[model samples]
Target chain A: MSFLSVQNIKHSYFTKSTAVAALSDISLEVKEGEFVSFLGPSGCGKTTLLSIISGLIEPTEGRVLLEGQPISLADAKIGYMLQQDYLFPWKTIEENILLGLKLSKRLTEQSKSASLNLLRQIGLIGVETQLPKQLSGGMRQRVALVRTLATEPKLLMLDEPFSALDYQTKLKLEDLISATLKQFNKTAILVTHDISEAISMSDRVLLFSPGPGRLHKVFDIPDVIKNLTPFEARNHELFPEIFQTIWKELESFETFKK
Target chain B: MKPSKNNADLLHKQYVHSLKREKRKVRLYQLLIFLLFFTSWEFSSKMKAIDPLLFSSPSKIIDLLFSKLHDGTLMENLSVTLIETIVGFILGTLLGTLLAAILWWSPMVSKVLDPYLVILNAMPKVALGPILIVGLGPGYASIISMGVIISIIITTIVVYTAFREVDSNFLKVLRIFGASRFQCFWEAILPASFPTIISTLKVNVGLSWVGVIVGEFLVSSKGLGYMITYGFQVFDFTLVWLALLVIAVFATVMYQIVAFIERKIVKE
Candidate 1:
C-alpha cells in the first residue's frame, strides 16, 4: 500500500448564502519515503487538500489513508507546517518545539532530549530558552520545523513553508529541509506555487488547476535532479528543462481560466 | 572610526538625557495642575467667592477626614465599601470569563445567547440596583450583586469577542496535534486572551465601584455611598467631599494594581 493515499476527496465550504466547492474528486498517492509537490495557483485548494490529508479537515465525500489505515485514526502521526511559523509567541523555543510531544502525552526525558538534539541538528543551537520574537524570520521558521518534527511524524505536510522567507533564506532552508527529510527517510508532501521550488525539492510535481482544484498534470523529476539537494538541483543543467515544462502547464491553466 | 564611534555614544547620551527631561517636564505639569485646582478651590472658599456650604474647601474636607479617622467611622465605612468593591470586581471578572469560555466551547450556545448578551450589555445595569436590593435584601449581598451585575454583561461580551478573535491558525496547530477542546483552551486560547482579559479587569474596577456605590445608595446602608447620602441630608458637603476623595484614591490604586499585573503577566 502507498504510504499516504488521498481517495476521491471532495470538500466544500458553506456560508449562510453560499456553498463554495473547494476541492473536487481529488485522488493521489505517495510511495513510502517519496517527496511530492502540489504546484498550483491561488484558490487551487492546495491548502485545503493538505488539511484533509493531515486530518485537520474532514472531506465532504472521501477519505485519506496513511499506511493503509484511515488518516483520522492515525492521530499525532502527521506533522503539518504552515506558510508562516505560527509559533505561540508566548512560548519559548523549547516550549514550542516540545508542544507536539507534550500534547501527545509522549513527552519523556528521552523524547525531550531527542527533540533538543533535533533542534541542534537543524543548526538552531542554544536558542531553546529564547522566545519566538527574539529569533529572525528564518530562525523562527526553523524552530517551527523543529516543533513539527519533534513528534516524529511518519508523514510531513509542508504548505508553502518557505514562501514567507527571503529568497536567500528560502533557498538555504529548502536544502536544509530536503537533507533532513532524506536523512530520516521520511515521506513529505509540499504545496507551493513556485515552479522552481516544486521542481527542485520534489521527486514528482503534481500540477493542480484552480477553481475547485483538480489535478491537471504530473511531472516526474529525473533521477539526476532528484538525487541532488534542492539547492544543487536548482543549479543542475536539467533543472531549467523541467521548470519550463511545468511553468507552461501552469500558465495554460491561467489562460484557460480567463 | 574610533572618534566616530565616540561621537555616536555622545549623541546617544544626549538623546537619553532629553527623554528624561521630557518625562520630568510632564510630571511637573501634572503636579502643577493638581496643586492649582485645589489651591484655587481653597482660596475661593476662604474668600467666600464660592458657596462654602455647597463647594466645601479642601481644608474643611481634610479636617473632616482627620476627625472621621479619629472616630474610626471613616475606616469602617471605607473598609466596607472596599471589600464589597473588591469582591464584586473579582466575581464579575471570574463569571464573565467563565461565560466567555462557555460561549467559546459551544458555538450553538453562543448563537443562542447572542441577542440576550447584546440586550443585557445595552440595558442600564444600575437600573437593576433597586431590584437587586429588594431581592437580595439591604445588605452586602445586594451591594455585591449590584457590583457584579453592572460589569458582568459587558465583560462577557468583551471577553467572548477576545476569545473568538484569537487567531484560528493557533487552534489549527493544536487540532493537528489531536489536542482535545479543553487542551486547546488551556494551551492557546486562554493564554492568548490574557491581555484582553487584563484590560477588561481594568475597566471592571471602575464598573464595580459604580455598582457597589449605587447599590449602597438604594439600600441606604453603611458605606461611603451612605456617607455621601447622609452628608447631603444634613447639608454637610465637607463630609461628602471627604467620601468622594477616598473613593477616588482607592479606585486609582485598584487600577494601578491591575496595570502592574498586566505588565507582569503579558510579556510582549
Candidate 2:
C-alpha cells in the first residue's frame, strides 16, 4: 500500500441556493519519503486537495488513507504549512516553533531541545526570543516551517508556502525546504503555481486543470537520485526541455479556460 | 561635476533649514496660542468682562488646587477616586474578559446573550445609579458596581468580536496539528486578538472612570465627583472648576498608562 493514498476524492461547497464543486475525481498515492508538487493555477483547488489530504477537510465522496488506514486530523501526525506563515505575532520564535508540541501536550525537555536543534539546523538560532514581527518575510516563513516540522509529523503538506516571498527568497526557501524534507526523510505534497519551483523540488509534478480541478497529467522526473537539490535539478541538462513542456501545458490551460 | 555636487549639498542644507524653521514656527504658534488663551482669561476676569465667580480664572483654579493640596483634601479625595477607578477598572476588565471567553467557548450562549448585552451597553449607566445604590447600599460596592456595569458589557462585546475575528487561517494551522479548541484559542485567537483587547482596555479606562464619577455624583461621601457635587451645593464654582481640572488630568494620566502598555505589547 502507498504511504498516503488519496482515493477518488470529490468536494463541493453548498450555498443556501446553489452548489459549487471545488474538486472532483482526485486520486493519487504518495510513496514514502517522496516529494510531490501539485502544480496548477489559482482556483484550481490545489489547496483544497492539500487540505483534504491533510485531513483538515473531508471530501464529500471518497477518503484519504495514511499507511492503509483512514487518516484523522486528530491523530496529530500531519503538518500543514499554510500560505501565510500564520506565526502568532505575539509569540516569540521559539514559542511559535514549539506551539504544535505544546498544543499536543508533548512538550518535554527532549522535544524542546529537538525544536531548538531544528531551528539551528535551519539557521534560525539567535531569533528564538524575538517575536514574529521582528523577522524578515523569508525568516518568518522559515520559522513557520520549523514550527510545522517541530512536531515530527509523518506527512507534511506545504500549501503555497513560498508564494508570499520575493523571487530570491523563494528560491532560497525552496532549497531549504527541499533539503530539510530530505534530511528529515519526510514525505511532502507541495501546492504551488510556480512551474520552476514545481519542477526543481518535486520527484513527481502533478498537473491539475482548473474549474472543479481534476488531475490532467503527471510527470515523473527521469531520475530519483538521493540528495538531488532543487538548484542541481534546475541546472540539469533535461531541465529546460521539461520546463518548456510543462510551461506550454500550463499556458494551454489558460487559453483552454478562455 | 564637483560644482553640481556642491549645489546639491547646498540645496539639501537649505531644505533642512526650511524644515527646521517650519517645525519651530509650529511649536511657537502652539505655545503662544495656549499662553494667549490663559492670559486673555486672566485679563477678562481682572477687567470684569466675564464673571470670575462662574468662570474661574486659571490662576484662581491653580491657587485652589494648591490650597487643597496643602489641606490634604485634594490628596485624600484623589486617592479615594483613584482607588475606586482602579478597582472598578481591574474588576470590570477581568470579569468582562472572562465572560467574553465563556461566550466565545459556547456559540449558543453568545447568540442568546447578544441582544441583552447590546441593550445593557446602550442603556444609560447613570440611570442604574439609584438601583445600584439600592442593591449594593451606597458605598464602594455600589460605586464599583457602577464602573463594572458600564465597562464590562463593552469589554465583553469588543473582546468577543476580536476573538471571532481572529484569522481563521491561523486556526486551521492549529487544527491541522491536532490542536483542540482550547489550544486554538490560546495559541491563535487570543494572541491574534491582542491589539483589539488592548484597545478594549483603553475604552474601559474611560468608561470605568465615568462610571465611578457618576456613582459618586449619585451617592458618595468622598471622591472628586463628590467634591464637585458638594461644591455645587455650596455654590463654590471655583471648587467645581478645580475638581473638573483634577478629573481631567487624572483621566489623561490613566489613558496614557494604558497607551504606554499597548505600545510595549505591540513593540514586543
Candidate 3:
C-alpha cells in the first residue's frame, strides 16, 4: 500500500451563477520517504489538490488515504506550509512554534524541548521571545518551517513555500528543507510553478494541466541528481535537459489553452 | 569612514532636535488656543459685548463651581453621572462583544439578525430614552440602560465585522492542527481583534456618555444632565456651562486612558 494515496478526486466551487470545476479525475500515490512535486500553471488547482490531500477541504468526489486510512481520520499527521509564512504576528516565536502541539494537546516537556531543538537545528537560535515582525522575512520563513515540523507530521505539503522569498533565500531554504525532510525520512509533496525547483527537489515531478486540472505527465529524476542536494541538483549536467523537457511540456499546455 | 560616521551622528541629532521642536510648537499652539478662547469669553462677558446671563463668563462659572464644590452638590451630581456612564460603558462593551462572539459562532444567527442589526444601528438611540426611563423607573438602572442601549448595537456591528475580517488563513493554520471552533476563536480570532476592540472602546466612552446624559434628561432626578436641565429652568446658564465643561474633561480623560491601554496591548 502507498503511504499516501489520492484516488480519483474531483472538486468544484459553486457561486450563485456558476459551478466551476477546479479538479477532475486526479489520482496519485506517494511512497514513504519520497519527495514529489506538482508543477503547473495558475488555475491548475495545484493548491486545491493540496488542500484536499491535507483534509482542509473535501473533494466533491473521491477520497484521500494515508497509510490505508482516510485522511480526515488521520489528523495532525499532515503538515502544510503556504507561500507566505502565516505566523501569528501577535504571538512570540516560541508560542508560534508550539501552537500546533498546544492545539493537538501534545504539548509536554519532552515535546517542547524537541520543538525548540528543531528550531535550533533550523538555524533560528535566540529568537524565542521576539514577535514575528521583529524577524526578517527569511528568518520568519525558517521559523514557519520549524512550526510545521514541530508537530512531527508523517506527510508534509509545501505549497510554493519559498515562492515569496528572494532568489538567494529561496535556494538556501530549498537545500535546508530537502536535507531536513531526507533526515526525517518524511514523505513530502511540493507544489510549484518553478521548473528548476521541481527538477532539483523532487524524486518525481507531476505536471498538471490547467482548466479543470488533470494529471498530465510525470518525470522521474535520475539517481545521480536525486543523490545530490537541491542546489547541486540544479547545477548537475542533466538538470537543463530535464528542465527543457518539462518547460516545453508546460509551454505546450499554455499555448494549447490560448 | 570615521568622518562619515560622525556626519551620520550629527544628522541624527539634528533630526531629534527638529522632532522635539515640532512637538513643542504644537503644544504652544494648543495652549494659545485655550488661553485665547477663555480670555476672550471672560472679556466679552465682563464688557457686556455678549449677553452676560446667557453666555456666562468664565469667572462666574468658576465662582459657581467653587460654591457648588463647597456645598458638595457638584461632586454629588458629577459622581452620579460618572458612575452611570462608567457602568453603562462597561456593560455596553461587554454585551456588544458577547453578542459579536455569538454572531461569529453561528453564521445562521448572524444572517437571520443582519437586517435587525442594521435597523438598530441606524435608528436614533436617544429616541428610546423615554421608553427606557418609563420601563426601568426613572432611576440609575434606567439611566445606565440608556447608556448601554445607545452604544451596544453599533459596537456589535463594528466588533463583529472585525472578527470576520481576521484573515481566514490564520484559522486555516489552527484548523490543520485539529483545533476546535472555540479554540480557533480563543487562539486567533479574539487576540487578532484587540486593536479593533480597543478603538471601539474609545468610541463607546463617548457613546455611553451621550446615552446616560440623555437618560438623565428624561428622568430629571439627578446627574450632570439633570443639573443642566435644572439650571436651564432656573435660568442658571453658568451651571449648564459647568456641567458641559466637566463632561468634556472626563470624556477626554477616558479616551486618553483607552489610547494608553491600546499602546500597551498592541505592540505593532
TM-scores, each model vs. reference: 0.97, 0.91, 0.98
Candidate 2 Cα misplacement greater than 4 A, ranges:
A224-227, A247-258, B1-30
Tens-place lDDT digits, model 1, residues A183-230: 999999999989999999999999998888889888999999999999
What ordering of candidates by DockQ runs from best to worst?
A: 2, 1, 3
* Residue range with the least summed lDDT across 10 consecutive positions in model 3 chain B: B129-138
Best by DockQ: 2
User: What DockQ, between 0 and 1, does each candidate earn?
Assistant: 0.66, 0.79, 0.66
| Model 3 residue A29 CA deviation in Å | 0.7
Which residues of candidate 1, in runs, are more than 4 Å off?
A: none
Residue A214 of candidate 2: its Cα lDDT? 93
Candidate 1 lDDT tens digits, B175-223: 8888999999999999999999999999999999999998887785699
TM-score of 1: 0.97
Write the residue-wise lDDT of candidate 3 on B164-259 in tens digits. Answer: 999998988888888999999999999999899999999999999999988888885788999999999999999999999999999999889989
lDDT of 2 at A172: 89
- Per-residue lDDT tens digits for candidate 2, residues B158-248, read 8888898887998898898788888888877787778888888888889999999999999999999999999999988889999998999
Q: Return the clash pairs for model 1, or none.
A: none
